[model samples]
Target: MSEAVAPRAAIIRRLSITRFRGIGNLIWRPGSGVNLILGGGDVGKTTVLDAIGLILSPVNPSTLSDTDYFGRDIESGFEIEAVIALPVDSAISAQVRPAWPWAWDGKDAVVPALDGDSGEPVYRLKVRGTEDLELIYEVLQPDGSTGNLPVMLRRSIGLVRLSGDDRNDRDLRLVQGSALDRLLSDKGLRSRLASELAEAEVKDALGDAAKKALADLDNTFSERSLPVGLDLSITGGQGASIASLVGLTADRNGIPLPLASWGAGTRRLAALAIAEQRQGDRPVTIVDEVERGLEPYRQHALVEKLQDSGAQVFVTTHSPDAIAAASKASLWYVDYTGQIGPLDTNKVARHRANDPNAFLARVTIVAEGLTEVGFASILLRRALGAPLSQFGVHISNGGGHEYTLELLEALNSGGLSFGGFADDENGKHPTRWKALEDVLGPLLFRWPKGCLEENVFGATPEGKLEALMADTLGDRTGMRRQTLALRLGLDAKTFPELATAAGDRLRPTMLDAALGTVPAGREEDKGAYKSHGGTWFKSLSGGRELAGKVFTLGLWPSLKPQLLPFCNSVRSAVGLPSIEDLPQ
Candidate 1:
C-alpha cells in the first residue's frame, strides 16, 4: 500500500476588499499555479497586496496607523476579508470538523475553485476600521463561531507576501518574514550545529565541499586587504552570535560581501531562494513585480521556480516575459479604475501575450503596424505634452490591417470604445472595409494614401521634405527622396478594383510596377532607395522621433487634412475631451 500524504497548511481561498484605499469594493479569486495581476501605477495593485498582508497580521500591529485608513472620510468604514481554507484531510481538519462541520468536495490542493466552492472549517479574517479609528481583526474560529483575537495570539493561516526592493534594507521585510531567522530557529539544524565546532565534525555534517569552501573563505579574508575588516563565515545554528545565526557571507579580495552587497537583480533572486527554503508549510505567497530587475534568463528560471514551488503564488507584473510564462486562465487584469477580472479565455490570453501593457491601460489604442504606432504615439505626446499615459491611453500594435480589423471588432462587440489606426491598403477590399468601418465608425482612422509613408510625404510642404531628407538621411537622401516622391505620385490615383482583391496588391512592389515611366535603372541606385523618405520612414521602429523632426521645422501644419481626422477620431475613441470640452 502507498503511504498516505500528510495534509498541508491552509491557502487563501478567496479575497475581498471593501472601501479599502482606492478600491471601493473588489473580489479576487486566484488560480493555483500562478495568480497574475496586471495594472499600471496607483491602481490599487499595491493596496490589494498590502490589504492581504494587513488582514492576515494580528490586529493593531504597530505598523497599523492612521495612513492605513483608506481615506479621510469618517462616514464610510474600511474592511478587508479573506477566506483561508485548510485541507479536508489535514491534521487540523479533524480538530475543526467537530466545531465547523462543512466539508469541501473539490480538490483542496493548490488549484483554484472552479465555481467559488464554499468550504468549511475555513476561517475568515475580517479586519475592519471606523471613523473613530477603532479597528479589529476578527476571524471565524474552528467552533463554527467568530472570535476577536489579540494581535500576538492571532492565527497565521500560511500567508506570505513578497514586496519588491523599494522598501530597501529593512531587516525583516514582508518579502520573507526573516528567512535567515527561520533557518536559525530550526531545532534540528541547531542540534546538529551544536555538536560540531571543528574540522572533524564540520566535514562530517556539511560534506567536504561546503566545509572546505567555508574554510577557504576564512583563509582568503585573513590574508587580503580588507574593506570591512571582517572575515567571511557561515552563521551557525545557535543564538550565540547574531551574524552567526543570520546567514552566509563571503569575501571578495578580503572585502566581506553579504547578500545586500549584490546587485538588485541578484539580491531579489537570492532573497527568493532563501524564502523558498525557509518557507516551511506556508501554502500561499504573494509577489509584486515578479519580473523586476530579472534578466531574460533569470526571468525564465524564476518563473519556473515559482510555478513548481507547490505554494499558491499570486503575482502582479507588467512584463511580456511574465505574461507569456503563465496561462491566460490564470491571469487577471486590473486598471487604475475599479475594474478587476480574469482573462478567462485563450483568445484574451493571446491578445494580452502580444502586448503586456494592454491590460494595464484604461483605454487601448490598437495601431495597425509599427509605423502607425510611432505616429499615434508622437501625436499624443505633441498634443498632450506627455505620453498617452497622461490621458490613460495605451497603444497596441494591431500586427497588420486584418489584425486591426479583428481587434476593433472584438473591442466593439465587447462594448469597449474601438480605437484604431489602419493603412489605406485595406480600403481596396470594399466589403470587409465597410464591415470594419461599421464596427469602428468614426473611431477608425485610415491614412488617405498608401500608408504612413505616403501620408507623411504627401502632407509635408515641398522644400521641407527635401530638407528633412537631406538632414536626417544625410548622403543617402539625394536619390531616395526623389524616388520616394515618384512612388507616392504613382499611387496618387486609385484602382476601382484591387487586381487580386487583397492587401498584398496594395504594397509598393505592385504599384511601383504600374506607375507609367521612371528614371532609367534606378534599381542600381539601391543605396538611395533604402534612404527614400517612405522607405526610411518604414524602417524606423519609432515615429515619435520623426514627428519631432518634422514639427520642429514647422513642415507639416497641425491642420493638414490627413492629420486632423486621424487625431479627432483617436481622441474621441479614447474618451479624451475635445478642446471645446476643456474648462474655460
Candidate 2:
C-alpha cells in the first residue's frame, strides 16, 4: 500500500508590523523559496523574526519580556498582523471561518484585491500588549474589522523559528516534542499520543523493541528525507517500566554523540532537519543569521537546501556569499527608515564585480577595471577615515567599460545606488556612453584624457611622469617572483631603449610599450592593458597605495577640479557631507 500523501496547506502571504523592537512600521511580503533579509546590525532583521514567532507559533509562549516591546516601552503596545490565505477545505478553516473575509475568486482562491471585493478572505493574526502589560493575540476578521477570534484558530498558522543562538534546543526527543517526533507522525502532525504515530503497531514498544522498530523504519527512509541526520527511538527509564522518547542521541562508529556536543553548524543544520518535518498542511521557517558558523561551500548550499524544503524560508545575513547565492528578487533591504521591501529585478540588472561584499552594500562604486577598484577604494577609505563597510559602500571593478552599464542596471534593480569612473577613451562609443550618461546623469565621472595610467597617474610627454613614478613607486617583490617581470618583458630602465627600437611597432598611445606587452623590436600594435601592463598592475597589488601617491605628488590639487563631480557623487551615496560643503 502507498503511504498517504499529505497536501501542502496555504502559507502566510503577508506580514505587517508596528512599533515592534527596532521596527516602527513595516510590511513583509515573502515569496516562495527564500526571503533573505539584509542590513547593518540593529536594523530590525531579528525583530522581524521575533514578531512572526510571536503571532504564529504552534506552542503558546510565555508572557512578553520587557525587551520584547519596541523601545522597551511597556506602555506603547506593539502589533503584528499577518494574512494567511486559506484554501477551500483548509484544515484550520473550520476554526477560523468567522474571521475569514469569506470572499473567493474564479479559481476559488481569495482575491481581496479583485474589483469591488469588499474584503479579502485572509486569516489575520494580530498580537498586542494590554494595559496590564499582558500579551494577547486577537484573531481579527479578514478586513481587520473585528477581533477576539476562537482560541483554536491560532493553531491555523505554523511557524518554526531557529533562534540565532540555541538551535540545539530543537533536537530529537519525542518526549519534549522534538521536531523529529513531529515529522515522524502521520501527515507531519506534532503529537504526543499513539494516534499520531505513522505506524500504529510500533507505538507500544518499551526499549530495545522501540530501537528495533526505529531501525527497521530507517531502512525505508534515509536521513536525506529530512536532509539532516536524526535517527531516533523510544527508551524505557533505567529503573522504571515506562517508555520515553529518546531525544537527540545519535552515534558515529558506535560511539554515542549527543546534539549538545556538536558544533554550532551541526546543531543548526539538525534543527532545520527537524523543522523540515514540522510542516503538516502549512509551514513557515524563520532563521536568523542563516550563514552563521557555516563554511563557504555550506553557505552556498544552505540557500539551495532551504529553497527546496517546500516551505517559505526567511533568513537574515551579512555574508556576501549568501547575498550572491540569493536571487535579486528574494532579497529585502531594511534601512534606518524602517522600510523592508523587495528589489526590482525585472530590469536589466547587473553586478559585474561579482563580489558579495559589494552586492550587500547599499551603495557601490562601479570602477572601470581592477586598478580603478584599488584606486577608488583607497581614496574612499582615506576620505571616510574608515573602511567602505562602515558606510555601506562597495567598490566594484566592472572588468571593463563594456560592462559598466550592466553593473549599473543590476545595482539599480537590487536597490543599490552606484556611481562610476570610466576612461575618456570610452567616448568613442556613443551608444554605450549615451546609455551610461542617461542612466547615471551627473553621477558619472570621466578621466580627463586617455586611460587611468595616463590621466590619473600622469601621462608621459605631457604629465610630470618622472615625478609621478618616483613618488608612487612601491616595493617590488612579486615582480621578480616566478619570473613575472621577465615574462612581461618589463624593465623600466629599458623602456627608452625599447621605445627607440620599437619604432612604429608601438600603438600611437605608446601604451603597448608602457604595459610591456611587446619586446622593443617586435612589430605589433597593442595597448598597455592588452600586453604587459595588466599583469604588471596585478603584481603591484598597490593600486590604492599608488593612487595615494598621487595626493602627495601634488596631483590631487590639479586633478581635484576634474574629479569634483565624482567625489561629490561618492559623498552623496554614502550620506556624507559633499566636497563643496567642506571649507577651503
Who wins the TM-score comparison? Answer: 2
The lDDT values for all models are 0.57, 0.59
lDDT of 1 by residue, 355-386 (tens): 77776676567888776788778776655545
Model 2, global lDDT: 0.59
* Pairs of colliding residues, candidate 2: 9-281, 172-247, 172-248, 173-247, 349-409, 349-410, 350-410
Runs with alpha carbons beyond 4 Å of true place in candidate 1: 1-9, 58-60, 63-66, 89-123, 140-146, 149-155, 166-275, 278-280, 292-296, 318-329, 344-364, 387-394, 405-419, 423-578, 581-584
- Candidate 2 lDDT by residue in tens digits, 1-584: 11112236455667888877777777767765578887656557888888877776554565667676677887887888777665556545565345555342222224255454333355666778654667777766545466664334554445556678854455444433335545554432333433344344444444887767766677656744743332534333433211124447679789988775677777777777777655444457787887777887887877778777766778888887776676532767664344575654433235512555544556656788877788777776666657878877777777777776565655444333457777777356767666666766556776756776666545233234333333135543233221232434545344444345444542233433234445454445434335545433432254665566567555676566766667666666566777652122
Error of 2 at 247 (Å): 4.6
TM-score of 2: 0.65
Q: Judging by lDDT against the true structure, name the best candidate.
A: 2
Give model 1 RMSD, 1 decimal: 13.1
